[model samples]
Target: MSDSVEQQLSLFRYLIQTRSFGDSTLRFLDSLLVSKDVKSLVEIRSSLNQLLKSESLSIIQSITAESVHNKLIVLDFFVCAFAIVGDLESCLALRYEALVVRELKSATIQLLHVSPLEWLNFVEDAVKNGFHAVAVKACENALRCIGNSDVQKLGRDVISDNLKANTISEITRLRNFSLASITSRSVQVQATEYLERKTREQQKLDLPYKEKRCLASTSFRNGIKRQNMRKLYKRQTLLRANSEMQGQHPNLS
Candidate 1:
């Protein structure tokens, strides 16, 4: 077999060994990797969605830390695979599901704790893919996790106080960045809706043709100006935030 095929087989076996997936789910993933087509992707997504639902129910029935951790690992693998195949929508959906699972686990068992760096990575990935809402939710979850006294005690036991402080500081910075991104996106959406409303109003107005034209032109110009200003401000805000993050987290690329 070719090296590429060998590598694929190796990865498939590794996934099977590591993830606690059922036979059907494994088959779906195998099909996805082998075909790398839309149909296969859809099949895998459907199978994984069902698995997530079942796992969620299982968690409710009995909240075992091992089971929750296994589910999270499977989800991480699914998200990474979907991303590799360039299925942003599926990846995002799976990522959100993983977040939900984490939240549920945190709420129920309160034993399986997700680290700040893991949350940071998820937020970064969400932001990079323009999933601002997901990124913001992730930031919120991360902040909540950090605020938990149990999680703080666990972190203190595992790492030095200085390291934990740095991690918390970085998570805060990323949370602010994610909030800004969502806010900018929200503004853009509102601006688009406002422009659309203005256009509809202009169309329905009972003014003279010249007056209508002038009114529409002015409205369009003003809307464009406002949008441009918002865009410029967003750029500046993001740049400033990124600069600060880089300066603070020199190890992050």
Candidate 2:
């Protein structure tokens, strides 16, 4: 392998093998982050965007931005995520650089500078096992509490359990939401179909019932003509009878 690859591999290996750092150890990493190669923290979204064609969601649950706050995994994951995606916002780089000058908030920002291979394994596990949140929180807690050699091992265990719990909880919530949405959508569809069917049924039922259809002016006019024809016949009959009586009375006159 080329010398640069070998060197990067060595650095990656060192980062993984090292335990979560305490105050002094973190301070050292803060210094190391000044270098350019490691600080592509903001490109995570773009790099991973295409990789997210399908989400099992069982593997990674939706989380509020607040749920991820002040955690070591949150910070480092942001770094990795931004690095992969592309740094649209300079915030990741600024944050990474700022910590180099200012001591990270009292909370230990866990820096697990693993090799590309190891980083892949860790991230893949999170995606596959639905434990990213757990992993993140575990690392955060590990960094915050890890002290001497004796504490580091113990801290890792504790952090791992905490991360697992968090991951399980988040996954459960998502599963519930998905199930609820399915139910809601199904209900809405059924209701709409039923309403449409009922509307059609009502229209069919109403078809048999007729409102009073008003007569057209032509029909009304015909009725008036028939009545006028009868009246004219009666008037002509009266005139004929009167004329016959007057003629019969002429000899008497």
lDDT of 2 by residue, 89-122 (tens): 3323323332322223323433432212222333
lDDT of the candidates, in the order given? 0.66, 0.42
What is candidate 2's CA lDDT for residue 166? 51
Clashes in model 1: which pairs?
none
Q: What is the TM-score of each candidate against the true structure?
A: 0.50, 0.28
Number of the top-ranking candidate, with TM-score as the measure: 1
Q: Candidate 1: list runs displaced more than 4 Å.
A: 1-81, 96-111, 150-157, 206-253
Question: For residues 11-75, could you state the per-residue lDDT of candidate 1 as single tens digits?
Answer: 65455554445555455454544544667555545554554444434443453445866777667
Looking at model 2, residue 224 earns an lDDT score of 94
Give all candidate RMSDs, comma-separated.
27.9, 18.5
